[model samples]
Target: MSASLYLVAMIVIPAIGAAAVAALPRERGLLAKQVTLGVSLVVLLLAVLATAAFDVDGDRFQLTTSVSWIPDFGAEFALGVDGIALVMLLLIGVLVPLVVTASWHEADAGPRPTRVFFAWLLLLEAMMVGVFVATDVLLFYVFFEAMLVPMYFLIGSFGGPRRQYAAVKFFLYSLVGGLIMLAAVIGLYVVSTSQLGEGTFAFDALRQLDIDPEVQKLLFLGFFVAFAIKAPLVPFHTWLPDSGAEAPIGGAVLLVGVLDKVGTFGFLRYCLPLFPDASRFFAPFVLVLAVVGILYAALLAMGQTDMKRLVSYTSISHFGFIALGIFAFTTEAGTGAVLYMVNHGLATGLLFIVVGMLIGRGGSRQIGDYGGVAAKAPLLAGAFLVAGLASLALPGTNSFVSEFLVLIGSFPERPVFTIVATVGIILAALYILLMYQRTMHGPPRGVLLQQDPAEPLSGTGTGTGTGTGTGGATAASATATATRPAAPGTLRVLDLSRRELAVVAPLIALIIGLGVYPQPLLDLIEPAVSATISDLGGTDR
Candidate 1:
């Protein structure tokens, strides 16, 4: 297939699948999931093919398809992929199947299995593809802003107790940011019309039209604010923890996995290339904010008691690294940032899926409620540990390579900021270990733990009087004894089933693979990033 057709297929196939799934009878939910997975796998294969077809030695943008949607206003249906966009597309392709697997059990949770859940998920897959593929700034903006709809519904309709509130907050923050960017989009269109003799929203054409430095800065802020909100950087990131915590695991995965990257992607795709002087002028300030966010979010993560919120905070911290790398403007850092975006999607998406499993088994997200789960559910705990290590950027994990490259790339230009950001790495270890200790280590204390009758014994006995002196021992002992158990001290609860394993195993494999061999991803990203830098008058050769 032509690359353009591949791009269209990425959006269309999932959409059609969503509609088909929605129309299926509730009893055929299994068929719906299978169809969703099949479609997602096909999309992933197409993305892989697109990657293979991408010419790293050639010009910046490749395999483009453009057609005028509205000739009068200079809007068009445009699609293309640079290395950065290609990486994000690959991330989406990988993540959606995992999300479908993660949510498969949810179909049986409510009174009636809502095929609408799968439909929204598939629809979201299409929108995310559009966001990454669209080359026209206005088209990008439309896709960028339109993404909130399916996501909002997914969260609100299928989410937890405060789903409505979290969903509304998410929508409002995104809407406001998009509105600000809309003004900038309008401004760019007008400027292009007046100066270039015709209005155009094509990214290449817009890149050629220079605006006043002051106007450029304003436009940059307009775009930056939208991206930051989407990236959910530091102060703009408050909505994430709540939304992530409230949304179902599938929703949380996509929110952090594919959606958040749009912000960082915007900076690289639009902010740097379109407003080069402003990017340079704003670099130091943005760098400082990025470092501050890294440390701030890490510190917040260290104090989180809710498992979901902790993961959310780590995402903010991870984005801080992506921002720092992008604003640093070095080829290595930029490439690392792009890779970091992909790594975060994989690792963090796995983390959320695993956490959801824990919540599914334990009936609570409170860190203090779980203990000795590792003994009972070794497979699940192992998956969680790998994901956590990836989050902390441990050696031999995917995040470690990207984060190391980011720091090394930024150090020469922004040593102090890089130093501050490095502390976040240390804090990451602390919070992740702390979270693991709380949820997987000591003893099971919550209602879900009590429900497990055959709960195994690991380091210590399952009795309350083991005197480990941990936070949850007493509560877990009491809860465990209270629940129905086949034996006196053992509780039988479900562990990671084959389906759960199917969802997370690929992520773990990729984390290890990418950690070991990131060169291919880096090589592809470097040429396009160099081209971007050359466009900004930074450097390419």
Candidate 2:
């Protein structure tokens, strides 16, 4: 198949797979899961091949193909990828399979049919792929709006007790943003018509239009609000905690991992290139939001009792760094922002997966309910610790390099904002370590030590009470007594199974591998970032 066809197939195959999985016998949940996994693996392979075929020093957009769709309006069913889009595509590719694997037993808790769950997941993947590859602004908007359907179902049908509420909130927030963007999309086409003597929604064509300064600001606000809500900066970020906490682990992973990146990606792909004057005009205001998000979200994360909610808040703070990098108008920061998108997905996705496993074992999302988990499940605790440390951007982990790049790159351009944002790292360390200590250390308590009320304590004597001061003899007798076997609901934690290990192994490898050397990813990202900076009339240094 030709290279452009590969992009089309990456989308079509999973969509077809979703239909096929949905058609299978309702009783064959295991088969549906297997088929979904197989489909995701195939897509991953295609993504890898596409990455390999991508020439780093090539056209701004590669593997491109366009077919006219709405001739009167100058819209087309166009598709392609630049370095930024390609890396995002690779992220979608890597994550979907891991989510499928990690969610093996996640569907069992929900009332929905397992086939439907996997099917929705497959469909969501296809939509995510479409969003990144779409070259036509109209095509991109359709995919952007279309993504809400599967995710809505994923949360509303298969999420926690408040699934419906959370799903509605998520949908409404995104829907409102998308509608505002719709106005901007229409406005953009109008400007194109006036400038070029014809209407068009092709991104390449629209970027060349010399829009009026005032008009650009108005149009920029419409697009910026939509992306801010989607990127979920402060004030617009309330929906994420509810949605993230209520959605199934698999849905939550994709929600925070690949889905959130769309907003920041939009800013890079659309806002800067299309309205250079407007982007520079609004840089200071955006930088304020970015710095505020880093500090504010980090504080919120430290106070969360729900494990999933805590992780989701961390993503908000991480996104601030991405926004800062983008507006800094420097190659180092913009490239770091792109790389941060990929690394955050890996690190935070792994964190959610492990937290899900912990909740599965202990039967609670409350951090107060778990203590000394390490004693019973050392491997699981170790995985959670690694994920937590990576979340905090510890040295030798993937996030550290990206965070480093973002801070250093943004500093020269926006020193005060960069300095304020750096404080988030200290807060990050405190929250991650405190969370790990509370959940993994301390004396075994709560679920770890719940005992039958009828059963005697481990150090107690059999129906004997001594009021006398023979403490030495009593202590010796208690030490010599045999320990009782554990009863149900007590000390039942088990270590990670083979399948669970298989799920996390690749993420762990990537975390360390990319941390040690990020040059390969940098090579693919830097050229594109430089091109973008050049367009913005900024110097990399």
RMSD of each: 5.6, 9.0
Tens digits of per-residue lDDT for model 2, 1-541: 8988888998999999999999999889899999999999999999988999899999989999888889989999899988998988888889999899887766744566779999999999999999999999999999999999999999998776678999999999999999999999999998998889999999888877888989989889888988898887887899999988878888999999999999999998889988888999999999999889999999999998888788989999999999999999989999999999999999999999898777655445677766888988898898898889889999999999999999899999889999999999999998888889998988765543322222211111111211101112233333232122234435656677777788888989888899999888898888888888887788676
Relative to the true structure, candidate 2 has a C-alpha RMSD (angstroms) of 9.0
Residue 281, candidate 2: Cα error in Å is 1.1
lDDT of 1: 0.83
Q: Give the TM-score of candidate 2.
A: 0.92
TM-score of each: 0.92, 0.92
Candidate 1 lDDT, tens digit per residue, 1-541?
Answer: 7866788889889989989999999778778878888988988999999998898887688878888898899899999999999989899989988888777656444323567778888889999999999999989988898899999988787676577899999999999999999999999898998998988999999988878899899999999999999997878998999899878888899999999999999999999989998999999888877988999999999998888888999999999999998888788888889999999999999999898777655555677656777877889889999999999999999999999989998888778899889999999999999999877777555443433323321111111211111112343443444332333324334577777788889999999999999998887888888878877887332
Clashing pairs in 2: none
Task: Give the C-alpha miss distance for residue 119 in model 2, angstroms.
Answer: 0.5
lDDT of 2 at 269: 88
What's each prediction's clash count?
11, 0
Which numbered prediction scores highest in lDDT against the true structure?
Answer: 2
What is the Å distance of residue 256 in model 1 from its true position? Answer: 0.2
Write down the lDDT that model 2 would get. 0.84
